[model samples]
Target: MEYQYCETDPFKRPTHLLEANPRGMVPAIREGDWASGESAVILEYLEDRDRDATHKVPLLPTDPRLKANCRLWIDHINAKIVPSYFNLLRATDRTNQSEGIDRLQIEIRALVQAADERGPYFLGADVCLVDIHFAPFVLRLPRMLSQHRHWSDPIPGTRWHMWIEALERNPHIMATTSSSELYLETFDLFMNSRLANGES
Candidate 1:
């Protein structure tokens, strides 16, 4: 499955492509001919297609309950954990910013506790559906936190600290995502603009 960065959305998303998907959401996959949308459903399709094929990553856990648990964790982070972090960076009011960061910290702490059960990935060594689902956001968090001063230290002492460290050091992640240099460059630009605006 090749990924084409949508010109309109630099974050790699397609608009009309979602028409095939009833929900019109992203993170969709187009196979040899068929297409599927939604991260969880797409992930399941990929896993099923890779079951007998070589050269692809396995997403489903060996245990049924563990697979369900991974999805639960993904849902928690998507609906609660990630939105909290996003709110902190996007909040306009200083008071709202503080509240958002506080909420994000609380959510991260809980996620870190649950994440401790697995080493490396969300389900141990193997990267599963949940890992793939959240990988982009988690990988980008450091850069986002650094760019937005109000979002710094939002998840101190959380599982993300270690997870991020490991991610930064991973060859696959480094090859796939933005480099530290790029992150710093963007962070500096964002900070300069915020400072110029006299924003708190």
Candidate 2:
């Protein structure tokens, strides 16, 4: 299937998208007559579609237990980790921001422990749904943390750094990530504009 990219601005969304997804959030997909919203659901839809097509390498594991585990982690990352990271980023007050960072660090450590059990990727040797779900945020994390002047090395010798390093080498991840320079520039402008509006 051919993919078409639509750049959306949350502050001023396009009418067609608003019709498809009233919430106006991004990462939505439209497959012919069917349209769906939310990242996790979209990932599942793509994975199921590919599996049905008998793709050479299915994104989800074949084993039922392993597939369930992948879904669990994906939910955790979306529901817990991503929100904490965003809270830290948008916080205008120093104290609240610091607390938010601390919470994020705790969440990261938990994620590290989870990934360490499987090694390399969240689901053993191969990149799976968990990795795909979290990759976009993980790619942006180092820069986002640094921009706040609250950067610190992930506890020395932990899988936190190793996991990030391994992810950097993954072909799929590399294809998805923006250049650090571009990400930093865009993020700076976004934060500044949001701050100017007294948003948190």
Best by TM-score: 2
TM-score of each: 0.69, 0.83
- Kindly list the per-residue Cα lDDT of model 2 for residues 91-137, writing each as its tens digit: 76889878888888788777767774646777667777888887887
Candidate achieving the largest lDDT: 2
Query: Candidate 1, residues 1-200: lDDT per residue as tens digits?
Result: 45553312212234556544545455555655677766667767767866977766567777888878887888987898778765676576778877887797787667667774646666666666776666666766667764554456435444566566666676755556766676666555545656777874
Q: Estimate every model's Cα lDDT from 0 to 1.
A: 0.64, 0.75
Model 2 regions more than 4 Å off: 52-55, 116-118, 155-157, 185-200
If candidate 2 were superposed on the true structure by all CA atoms, what would the RMSD be? 2.7
User: Candidate 2's error at 14, in angstroms?
Assistant: 2.5
Q: Model 2: what TM-score?
A: 0.83
